[model samples]
Target: MSVELNKTLFNSRLKLIKDAWNNASDSEEYGSIADVGAFLVMAGDPAGEDDPIRKGTAFQQIKGGDNPIAIEIIPQAGAKEPSNDAIPRFVQAYISHSRVGSLLKETHTGKLVKEWEALLAAANSRPELVEISPAMSSFMAVKDDEELKIVRTAANLTSTLLANYIATKLETILDKEAKISHEDFSAQIEARLGSGEGDDAKGPDMKVWNKNPKLKDVDWGSTELCYSPIIQSKSTASGYDLKSTAESSPDMIAHSGVFLISTGIRYKGYCANMGRTIIVAPTKEQEEIYTLLLGLQADLITNIKDGAQIRAIYQHALSYIKDKKPTLEKHFVKNVGFGMGLEFRDSAYLLSSKNNRQLKAHMILNLSLGFADLVDDAGKKVGAENATILTEGVKSVKDTLFFEANDEEELKSSKPKKPPVKPLTNGHSASPVKNKTVAGKVLRTKTRSAAQEEVLMTTAAKIREHQIELHAALQAD
Candidate 1:
């Protein structure tokens, strides 16, 4: 991709999203498409006996593809690196900075504001399309917090929908619910994205796409299982790509009862990412590691705030690994988390090193940690292990955490009371909390009132119903 071509494609896609969003206020097809993500999926070349997957695909989505949304998964193109990768990054950078950059730079005043005004002027050169009475007012309107949120929602929707698609597809194949081969599965997923069945206006769900296909005469036992996983391609920071690949590890998929999914998408120009380790049936050891990872994640999320030290946080995770499980020493990636925004990777990062940078307010951080390969004594990976014994493989958990200016400032001004605690010789605090006893009992009462029980049951039922509806929607597509 050349510089000029890259710019052209980016502008075109950005225009597409913007037109859709602006028109969403009136048109049914656009429907709040503030964010979008496009990616390339390369499967090993079907034409050759053995060739690096020459076949790849790229997909774009708006607002989770509900309604008549703008989404497409172009096949035969975007297979090569540096081709489809640039689209999402450019989308994120342009939208994020365009909308939020002013808010971020309000501290500097004048220069940034003028720059934005000029850009707005260029964007809406013909006042007829978007009336600009006062340039500053128009710019400010574009930067409205609510509008910013819509963009964030759009980006998040893109990622969430993609994740759901992958999970649903995997479940279909693994459970034998759908007799779909690897080659056809990609097309199936792509067609659903393009169906625009997300909105009620588009008609009932699952009606847009062909649900029933003629079963081909083929021997199921002879065919190999095909899977095409999705990954995020670009980030503002160069090192932050979670690249999607055409090929997948059969051993890991077969032996592992769990899979870690992580990816990001951009909407209205901002980028959002999500990651989770989905567990099927698990052994005791696997359960323990999973719990530990969750605990570490909790610690990071609670401690995260403006002015927190990145190096210190990373060191804390490392220290936790040392104290909890020394066997994972080798698999510890230097980074536990990093900044996320306009680009997949931002300027600040979490790592154990001597650095002076402190976290700033409004920074989007991706907190994650996991073991790459935990091989049991048998030398097989745990997730896809051959025997009941432990195995070598990968496991991880990640979540997006943000630092808000208002929350941090409120916490500082409140000056909450704290109990006195002594520091250990190791420079760690042992802040043991005193337990509160009720009715001279060590544990809290377990009995629930009828009203409370009813409320809980109702909530649970609603959640289950929602899950069922979502599953049906995905499967139907």
Candidate 2:
């Protein structure tokens, strides 16, 4: 499809986002966020095609064993093409509510109403409101399929809603000057927004909520957000973004740390992932590095094209990063970007190694970079990423700016100046990375302690007893 046509389709989808939100927010049962906002397909390993778990999804396999969504077509009784417009052409439809389980809850009844109100107000007040409206959604357009349009629109709109929610929450926190920890911030977000089954909250209210007529026995949906301290210590090499359920707590050395919050929300049936590394009490150098990386990210966004080769674009970014910061040449990570859609990690992936593919119109991708303080690993130095929708032209997804061009340019022009830097450590000199091996080495196995052995034996005994009971029950049946 032509780029213009795709954009028209995207604009149409944007209207649907507002419609879905309005319908769900004001009404009780429709559920906020559409049923399936984005149709994302991830085929299992081709070898596993026969496996029961992987059987029904895909049939055609690519070189890397990734498969396309499976489909079956039968001629409609004497009709040329299927008259049912609901019938999809490319992939079979499957609905999973794991993402939007939270929307079903009564807790968000008030919040959704308020959120929609705020979105409408903010959207209307802004002079550059055209940018976020369905008309200006050129960044990425959905495929030319009606059902797919519904799915993509839902994902895009819900993402915007969550982004606004987080932004609003942060405004409140900042206004109060709350000295909150990452865990607390994430918890508050989950409550203010919604949480999935994975993050089961426990409390007297939760207990009562489960049994309450208006709130009981409801399925709360899923959202992905991770908050953590950016810097722990000199030796603790931790990434700012990680799993939502990870238990690694940041040290309270100075009673403050650079909190990094990353979120991946599965709203309804769509997914939206975003991350932010903020400095509550940042050092001079920390602030400098963050500014530098953000500027670099903006520059990279400007260079992206719809039909560009993903590898070439990635390599160019790597070169740019090296030029900007020559001191820590050895501390750079390999991945520059990756594909994000229905699944957290899917294609069109942005890998230097995978140059065979070119970014397509409406393909959404993430561009991220990581920097470790070679001088002080404990003093956090990292670059975070936000999701960008690939339009026919260049546009980036930033926190406040969103996909709008006016704000994006204003922010870029007023961006902080790059800090002074020392010359390259070894003049970009580096030896080839050697693979480690201990040839002919004998591996030793340690015997389990008596306490461990006893625990295992007792567990085995219980399992055997359960098995006997199950067998007896089966025989009786």
Compare the candidates by TM-score and give the number of the best one. Answer: 2
Over the stretch 164-280, how does candidate 2's per-residue lDDT look in tens digits? 455455545543545554445555555543444555843222432232243232234433222221222111234433433443334321222443445543433334345554333
| Cα error, candidate 2, residue 64 (Å) | 26
State the lDDT of candidate 1 residue by residue for 1-477, as single tens digits.
Answer: 221223444455456445555654464223222222222121221323222211110112112211223235332223364434333333344444322211111122243345444555555232212211111111111222332343344333433344356554554444443444333444444344333435632321233212233112212222111123332111111111232333222121321244444434444334444444444434456556665664555455545555667677777877787788888766665566554433344333434445444654444555556665457546855422111111111111111110112232333456633222111111122223222122211111123342233224433233223322211111111
lDDT of the candidates, in the order given = 0.36, 0.36
Root-mean-square deviation (CA) per prediction: 20.9, 26.2
Off by over 4 Å in 1: 1-151, 158-164, 177-192, 195-256, 347-355, 381-477
Superposed by TM-score, candidate 2 places the C-alpha of residue 85 at a distance from the truth, in angstroms, of 32
TM-score of the candidate numbered 2? 0.41
Residue ranges of candidate 2 with Cα displaced over 4 Å? 1-181, 194-255, 377-477
